[model samples]
Target chain A: MSQERDTRTAFMEATYRALCTHGYADLTMQDIADETDKSKAALHYHFDGKDDLFREFLAYLHEGFAETIADHPEGTPVERLVALVRRVLDPVDDSADQQFNTAFMEIKAQAPYREGYREVLRRFDADLRTEVADLVREAIENGQYDEETDPEEIAEHVLTYIHGTWTRAAAVGADVVAMREHLVDDLLDLLVDGASVPVDVDATEDRGLAAADPDEPHENSSEDVVDPR
Target chain B: MSQERDTRTAFMEATYRALCTHGYADLTMQDIADETDKSKAALHYHFDGKDDLFREFLAYLHEGFAETIADHPEGTPVERLVALVRRVLDPVDDSADQQFNTAFMEIKAQAPYREGYREVLRRFDADLRTEVADLVREAIENGQYDEETDPEEIAEHVLTYIHGTWTRAAAVGADVVAMREHLVDDLLDLLVDGASVPVDVDATEDRGLAAADPDEPHENSSEDVVDPR
Candidate 1:
């Protein structure tokens, strides 16, 4: 890489580390400069301010994600998608990634009140949905998935599950990798086969069975359907 | 109610509101006092300091959750459990609930660094797990669910999902109720019938196939279990 490109990479890495450690509220440009072994002026030349730096950082992360997806080997779409999830959840050195996750969430929390931030987040979210949806679409086209599957809804579900795992893991001090593994397993299970009902009920009869009183006799109910045994 | 009981309730409510509005770092005893229209001396008499006030607040919220579960109607375990989830995602005034959710996350973020805060969170998580686990166990006992289900794991999954939705909704300024409904549907789908695989593969064949192609293979392969196309 060119010297300029190398310097920018170093600055981005340093800023990411610092933001993770100190949080967005406490991070400073001087700290990034010191961490990157660059002068304050040099750091300023590359970025306008903290908000600018954060925007660039987010872009960098997005690019990294895109590269990860691009690098996924040709396979059944489900396999590649699972690999994508495993890669994202893989452990990194120190707790820097955790900090980054927290900082990202903090920024998201402020997005509603900050229009620029909201736009950034909205674009990022849309990008994520698009990427995952494409993969789902590929799976469907390949015939690995059922014809009735909805890629957009599945994408939303997967992304929501991932974010939820991260936030909950952080909240409870649980191992992110373990929680993620369990979550991915659950998600894959839902996607591949779909939900099953244990007791076979006639569709018309069972429509609102759960909504009715268990004590109330169903007009069409039989011992077999009720499973009284 | 007794005058002392009313005063204590007033003090607690005021402190909860203050913490929600101003956050932990900016909240003060004087603020709670002013909000409650009580003297600082009276506040001190009720609680020792900011720490004590927050500790009490945590306990109150925890107790409220317990009360909600207790008040769930008599029915099958699944119905009761669903009610528990609905109550957690209850839509109060968004203005107030948003502040509460924000404060709740803020305190959770700090739990790792503060022993007192960590203890409160630990207790809260443990209580939730126990309550949910018991419900799952009851369901199994009554044959409402399969015998293979692990209550602890299921409880963890449920709690993780709920907490995740709470933070994600707050982050995006979305309607929490709608988020909860979507989550519940997805979760129920997963639990009612275990995650389905597109096709059942012979275990030994699947293992060898996955191992042989560490990198996903594209298109037609001898071991391609589910034909995508």
Candidate 2:
């Protein structure tokens, strides 16, 4: 049993490495087999086929994402929330998280009809939200947030933005780093208890800096905010 | 050319019905063929395979979603915004929009991996955001929203929530109607310029109504919000 477990772990690790290297659509069985010392027969013996391997891989991915919640970075609730958002939304790495997200979303988009995908994702998503909710609840208790803030609602809101960024980034192939830095991360800033929403800050800051990039959205002449058709 | 167009329309309509009824994962060529008088060979002839058929089906879906933006309903910007939100987010019926969204998201989930799916989804998504941004811009110009409002960010923010809700709902069977009424629609409310964010209101209401569902996360006692570790 212990030997079998080692083989399973090896295959799982090999699958991850191959997925990251080759990507989901282009990934081939030999790609994963290349990472492992095991022969293709050994790999096939452990998993019936690609979908079977992917199912286990999906489970493995959940464990990794769920740990982000469990690891619970050290900081005040707001700081932790920032870290969580950065971990989930910000593209701090070259393509690790982004690649995972795009692939994860590709699989996730199938959740509605694929019961297996649906179940794993449902549990993992709920856990992630609960983690976020706990943080918001802690913030409120510590008085970082007003007593009136709803942990569930705020958790859902923040998760919504983070997840939305994932889906959009995956779909549109945007410069996520710029989008997050210049556009997205501020959503996290908005939740810092008494943090100013920066609704007007961008407009005023950009106007005086007239040297600001002309193509950027969010801040510009009100007349130009939406082009007239 | 006209004969080709008719055959294409018939296949698209059949695909829509088949997807809504059987869903994406279980969608078989036979299911679509059953919907139309044409033979399965006809569908195969029109498109190379499932991917090709789905590509055209996606274009059809975009035209449908894009029309919502083009067919701007007559009303105040706020009313129009609400109507737009309702059109996009609210599950109007069992089949029309919600079914399309669920099936559409299934295909979209593949966008992260499929370049063809990504391109079409990106274009449609950009157009949708532009529509929302336009509405916000008009609201600002009409003085419904403060001049300080950033149309692009606000549009992205709103679109993020809508898109996130769709993904979440697909992953987990959710009471979207309650969530929309209680959560998502309120995000729209925050955009009403001078309107109050329900952050405090929901908490206060939930606290007063203490009879609110115990399983509900935000409104309960702080102790209840997080299960004592």
Candidate 3:
């Protein structure tokens, strides 16, 4: 069982590398194989096919996200919320990271079509929403936020902003790190009581927001999707 | 030339019908042709292939959006902004509209891989941003909004919200029409001066936000993607 788990981890990492390199539209078992020591035959042995592999891959990612939330550092609800946002929106400076994000967006775009993918993404969305809602409730209970603040509504808006920021970042290379500050400030101003929450985010550190041209086409040098045909 | 333009319009409409029926992932030239009076060979005569047709389709959609903005009802900047938001987030209750939205999102997800799609989407984003920014500027000029309000920043945030809202609406069937109220309220509370810009929105009308289970998976009675392979 332990050996099987290690094999799956290796395959998941391999799949991630492959997706970053080739993207969803063009990714193949062969590409995944190139990222791993395992042969294409080995991949076939592990999964039914590409779709099956992708479904499991999304589940893996979803699990990872849930785990990250679970293992968040203990802090005041406000701090924990800020930390969560920061962690999720941490700047995508490296080409590999950007490529991976692009690929992930591609998969998300297909969620409407693939039930397996849609299920995983749905669960991911629900879990995140619950986490954010719980935190908001905690903050409200602790008297950090305004008494009238609706935790579910706040969570919904926060998730919307997060989703929007991420989509724009992946689709058009929008400056999210800059947007992150705006999001944090907006939440604090809207929810926090007067002179209660300290703005602890560092605005000085530029997180590669200026690196990419906002108007440039999505086809960057690092992440070009080859035509599978 | 007029005849040629009519023929192109027919094809574009045909493509739209096909996309509404068969999503981007499974869409084929034949499927598009099936929607038109024209044969598959006729579709080939007009364009190189599926990608070329899709590129033109996106351009067509972008142009239609621009025209829609131009044709917006004459109102104050605040009213116009609200109108625009209302129009875009117009209660997507009908299954046909829902299917079309899902298909459109699938195409957007593939934007990273397709330069033609990316270009069209980028132009769409820029045009929307400029329009929102200009409205915000006009509101500031008219003393409807705070003088301290940065139009560009407001536009960016608005676009992000729009993008995010669309994504969540498409991805998880989130209550957008309900969220729409929150968005309008947020803008008014944050930007508009006290009792200056009237909350002109009709909040009483239920626009299908209460129709769907927010936690339900995306696969519904409508909008199932058929795998071509």
Candidate 4:
């Protein structure tokens, strides 16, 4: 059983690499095979075809995303929320991350025609919405947000912003860095008392803003109070 | 010249009907031809292939969207903004609108891989952004919004919400009518003095809200003070 799980992980990683390189429209099993030690026949033995492999691959991607959202449980509700947005939107490396996002969106666009793809993408949306809603609930309980604030509404708004930013970035190569800053600021300002909370995010953290071009104007410079590491 | 223009309009409408039916991924010249009085060979005579025809099709779609945005210039900035959101998100018959949206998003998802699609989509984004920004500027000039308010920022945020809402509605069959109501309320409350703005949207207008199920609860019913038309 352990060996089977290991092989599945390997194939999923190979698919990620291949999809990032070739995108959804042109990706093939042979292309994914080139990224792994396994041959095309090995890929065929494990999954029925590209669609079958992609269904599993999308679920695998969602697993990673859900785990990332769950990993930081030690912060205030606002802090954790900011951290979650960073994990998704932080341009760790512009090219590879942007490539994956664009390709992933291409697959999502096909959801209307593909049941397997739609099911997995629905899981992604539901999981993210629930997690964000739970955080908002916690924030309200902690008195960080107003008692009247609807956790579900805030969750929907936040998720919509994230989705919108992703679509624009993928389709038109929009400046994601700026859009992410707006999200962070909106959360800090609207959802909570901005001055009372410590909204700092570490520059050297996984988002890799420390690697961003130093010359570019960072509008939300106040949020970068220190390297919290 | 007039005859050529009429032929283009006929083909564009035919392509729209076919795309709304077959969607972007499986759409072909034969499929498009079936919707038209013209033969498949006639479609080939006008355009080279699927991509070429779609390039023209996308531009045609944008032209219609642009005209719709420009049509309602007589209302208050806030009213005009609400009208635009309603036009996009109001569920006329739900099924047909949702089908077109899902298919449209699929094509948008391919924009990263197809420069022709990307160029046309960029035009859609640019034109919409400019229009929204200009409305913001108008509102600010008229003392409806704060003098310090950033027009460009408001425009980006509004556009992001629209794109995000479209993506969710397409992928998950989300409740777009509710999402659009939130947008209208946000525009009324945040951008303008909500009490002063007569936020009336005609139910019998092009948005076709009168066609919606009457049993559903309308949360922002206060905005429905009267239908002037």
| Candidate 4 ranges beyond 4 A from true positions | A191-195, A199-229, B92-94, B191-194, B199-229
Candidate 4 lDDT, B97-175, residue by residue in tens: 6778878887887877775888999888888888878877777787776665566776777788788888888877777
Clashing pairs in 1: A142-B228, A142-B229, A143-B228, A144-B228, A189-B195, A193-B196
What is the interface root-mean-square deviation of candidate 3?
Answer: 8.0
TM-score-sorted candidate list, best first: 4, 3, 2, 1
Q: How well is each residue in B91-126 modelled by candidate 3, as lDDT tens digits?
A: 677877877877887787677667678888888888
lDDT of each: 0.60, 0.61, 0.70, 0.70
Please state the error at residue B211 of candidate 3 in Å: 21
For candidate 4, give the lDDT of residue A135: 82
Query: Candidate 3 local accuracy as lDDT?
Result: 0.70
First chain of candidate 1, TM-score: 0.72
What's model 1's TM-score? 0.73
**Per-residue lDDT of model 3, residues A1-229, tens digit only:** 6988998889999999899888887788999988988899999999999999999999999999898665565567766776676667777888888888878877876777676887888888888889888988888788776566677777777788888888888877778777665666555544332434334322222111111223221222112111111
Q: lDDT at B88 for candidate 1?
A: 71
TM-score, one value per model:
0.73, 0.74, 0.81, 0.84
The Cα error of candidate 4 at residue A15, in Å, is: 1.2
lDDT of 2 at A79: 50
DockQ of each: 0.12, 0.24, 0.27, 0.32
